[model samples]
Target: MLEQLSSVFFDEANELLDNLESQLLTLGDNPNDSETIAAVFRAMHTIKGSAAMFGFTDISSFTHEAESAMDQVRNGVIPVTGELIDLLLKARDHIRNLLDAGAEVPENYKQVSEQLIIAFKIYVSKNGGNASLNQPVKKDVPKIKKEDKLSFSWRIKFRPSKNIMKNGTRPELLIKELTEMGTATVVPFYHALAPLSEIDSELCYFSWDVILTTGKSENDIKDVFIFLDDESKVEIEKIDLLPGENNRIGEILVDRKDVSREELDKILKEHRQLGVILVDKNMVSEEQVQSALAEQQHLKSLTPGGQVATPQSPASTQTLRISSAKLDQLVDLVGELVTFNARLEQEAQEKNIAVFKSLSEQCGRVVVLMRDVSMGLRMVPVSTLFSRFRRTVHDLAAQLGKHIEMATVGAETELDKTVIEKLNDPLLHLVRNSVDHGIEMPEDRVAAGKTSVGTVTLSAKHAGAFIMITVKDDGKGLDRDVIRAKGIQRGLISENDNLSDNEIYNLIFQPGFSTAKSVTSISGRGVGLDVVKKDISTLSGTVSIETEKGMGTTFILKIPLTLAIIDGMLVTIDNAKYVVPLNAISECIAYSMPAEEKGQRFVTTTNHGKPLNCINLREFFNFGKEPPAKQEILSVYDGDEVYGLVVDKILGSQQTVIKPLGPLYGNCVGINSSSILGDGSVALILDVYQLTGLIKNSSKKAS
Candidate 1:
């Protein structure tokens, strides 16, 4: 239970931090957005409470100070300035790290915390003095006024719905809330009870009563019961005001018969401004002002209204905190299920019994569903990955002394959880490359007829069964001369090679290829693009580049939807079967023996007169002698391109759960992973990227 509570605290803390980051970014652009400030305050307050409960005293204290700072902004006591926001953003990161590291913080962190707290205090004090004039001057109590005055007392009762207590509410807590309003005594009303044998522990059966001498009115007391009113009963009545009560505005107004409509209207207008205008204008006496203030307090308790609920901004939509162990467990279960289903199918085929056959078919469907659910559980939206870039752009642009604005789109697109995990590093490299190399300085953009704020767009979308992720920038596009020169200098390309523009652009991914004069910590060391290419390709994905001088450049990535399972076509090679993802197989045709025929167009030929790649499993894998008869050609196409992979037989298609080969064959070629055959044999899942690479190379040799 303690562990779960801690987990909940950290989870909520992380979420609050995300909200804080996003709101801070917006506040940078629109500082007057009070709603955003309120949202930031709420997130901080939630973090403070959760942290306190989880025993992170430092986090609770730090966030309490931060929340107080934000509350000042919300209440119009302070402005949301860029410098303050930057400090707060740094503070958020510090808090996030503290929560993640738990209670065992290093001594070095103490200085940073103290410095942040000092800054927060400075911020609060700077604007704290200019606060609303009517805000209560904290001081000792004064003696009561008698005759020319008025006094009133209020009795209040409250009963909360059972669910309130179940949801972590306590009647004592509510009574304590009333006490905070003014001097009041709490009395427990504990009569509603059931026999022990019939009682439900989760059910709440409690109520409360309170009497108070306060400057606030009856409405103020009733407001405390707003959330509980629907499920509980609440009663409030005015009594004779005590001696001190005559000085209370609420009491004085009631006694003077000034509780009329006209005065109420005047007080409500100046309510938020501290009611000084009403008092100064003599439209409402100080005692009446006190009661009106209490009425406002009651309204505040009802729903805590005053600001709009900010949109479920981009940052919150993308991330989920999950245990890596749980993910591994799920993968293991899916793998076992796939293996078992395969064995069952094999048994049913061998037995040729009606019951066994039906059971095998049912098992196949269940296996498919299981694989899908497991994979679905691992799917995460791309937005979570995108949010981190905001800080990166801000910091890097500042460091480089350049002005750039990063834009994002299609962040809601989803990718496999494992894939997203693997993608972060490569995406980071790409973004850094874009900012450091792709985009230009503010003056340069202006010289190039572009906006001073150069734009770097990071986006993702689904195209067919592939996820197309892109990183584009509208700065100075790839410089052809510089790239060609760098290629020659790095031995990536020869000056006499007559490389096309696309081929030249591809040279950027070559090892040790860079055009920067000096290497910096951020990006220009020439160690990133090559590694990024390798990482992306390892996932059976391809990265392509497009550029136009002075226009911009875009890097497009085409990757499979998920790595775990796919609808695949079973094909035979030398009587050894393999599974090809169905999404990649454009069509299958009968063997016209085109390769053996003369002067005829084959499927292994492209419209550009270049022969398409053909991978003959018999020759490539050396799977013994081929069968006498030629099998059909399974023409798999990715976009407009096609490949003819010749096999011995076409074995139909089925939904197959992809299982990774253990470390023994981690670097194996031709195959990406293995899947379980319905009959229980291990079927190799072909790596389309590797297979196509080999076929294309072989075609180049033959040509």
Candidate 2:
């Protein structure tokens, strides 16, 4: 199959740009780290090279300028500084815009590009020496002359590190790129690998003996190992040629002067370094160095731009360049499989045959495996989402003139690609808000007996089946009095009404709410935090805040692992059916009969708890029909506490594919999204958090 290589380039370029922006911002704070300097250099290098391949000529050209600057930092020719970092950030954004232009040249983008170049050159002039910031014009990259080329033949042996794949390089892709360089033949060397029982999937154990004949110099071949030089073992040597040079490897080697008579005799006697014998004896000239370098770079580019040496595993996997559409199709197939498995199992039980029943059980196992494989395809690390916030926090902190440090944990946590995509904007807003509004100024922090450097921690971890992503900041915590006063002024609450701390903190998420004494460009727009809450809740997730008077504040978001599918607890209320995410259900118990007080009945106690207020399903719906004498109360937890919701009956569990509620139901409260049952019934997925909010609001109004 003809592989589309540019997609990988785009994906990688984007990731590098994100890393570049984040690291540059961080370097602005601490510019002395040699490690971070190298990181910035690598990110720029990858973006520049990949952008070239994807036909992002302007991005490649523009990013080359930044890469040139970063390369100087990497080599210690220039010192990292705040001014340098700021200029690099502007450069990063411009490169991003260029990449975003994708195969088209957008009008006025050139002007933006020129502006960025001027800013970068100015910073270079200021922070860099007068020996000429823009004074040293970049030299054009040298290229080989194909027609005048002298081809050489050699046997190259390569064994990559175990983590080459993890580093985003596939040996298959490397091999393919190598083949593109010249006439090549590959012989896979699988002799040294351990048995399957002792293998590690992360390791690359196999090696290859390649016979390649290319007009490119040996240096050209060696350059291919640049990024992998630290991580793998590679050896290339010229060999003697046979009579028919064009027809066979042996003949080609003889023509290249790789295997001398002495070397061949030594091979007959005892083998010696073939390339050494040929080159040291002046058989190959200084000109060969150029081709060798080109070939080497060509080879190195096939691997990841950066890697480190590691052990190999017996199970070497191959990477296929599959289109994302194929993955979507696979996921759809798996979804259908799950539905059919449910149907088959249901039918088998009716047949009551042991043989068919056993087959159904086996099919169930296969279905589970297929579902996992499909889900894995959609599982992208949350690290991308988390890494993005680093830049946001850094830029906003600098803008707001706060000394805040961001610490992230559990970044390796995985979530659905769709979830990650939708989560980025909301997460960005939250981190920005924390950096601007949550963290106190360095002087204020010191006065409060706290460290001068405040902290914003972005963390993700699995709590049961749900992923909890929390943004916690150490600053002057939320002031309840300020929020309460604002609420009264806005008529969201009565002046004398009593409210809990949680309620007061949550008011900040109300639309058109702001407690800032004076609005600033960075925040206090009165629209950001509320949008964050709405966006999160739209994912069937819950957002809550915790704060201490002088310590800090935390905004915790609880989201499901995937939105495409979920395990839902089916229930009925009146004539309407509803689905509650099984992950949120703490338990379900029979609601005890209760006495009526003012035309309302409440469940006093069911499971060793105090009298908990519950609404009769029929009465809550105002169905005008008598409520079911018996009720099943589902206890749902919203990350903080649990509440029982009364329903008519539990109709078992289902795999529900979430469907967004259309604009017509835009104002519907308590219903987060709708999903389709296998039986073609539309089940309204209840937002337990919203439902609890409804109960709280109703009780407050009554009191």
In terms of TM-score, which candidate is strongest? 1
For residue 2, what is the lDDT in candidate 1? 92
RMSD of each: 16.2, 12.7
What is candidate 1's lDDT per residue for 307-414, written digit by digit as tens?
112346698689676786798688678877776777787788899999989989988888888888887887889888888788888878888988878888999999
lDDT tens readout by residue for model 2, 361-404: 89978877777778888998888888777777777878888887
Model 2 stretches astray by more than 4 angstroms: 1-8, 50-57, 102-329, 340-363, 494-498, 571-578, 585-637, 642-651, 663-671, 690-703
The all-Cα superposition gives candidate 1 an RMSD in Å to the true structure of 16.2
- Most lDDT-accurate candidate: 1
Q: Candidate 1: give the clashing pairs.
A: 151-241, 152-241, 248-287, 249-287, 249-288, 250-287, 250-291, 342-680, 346-679, 604-612
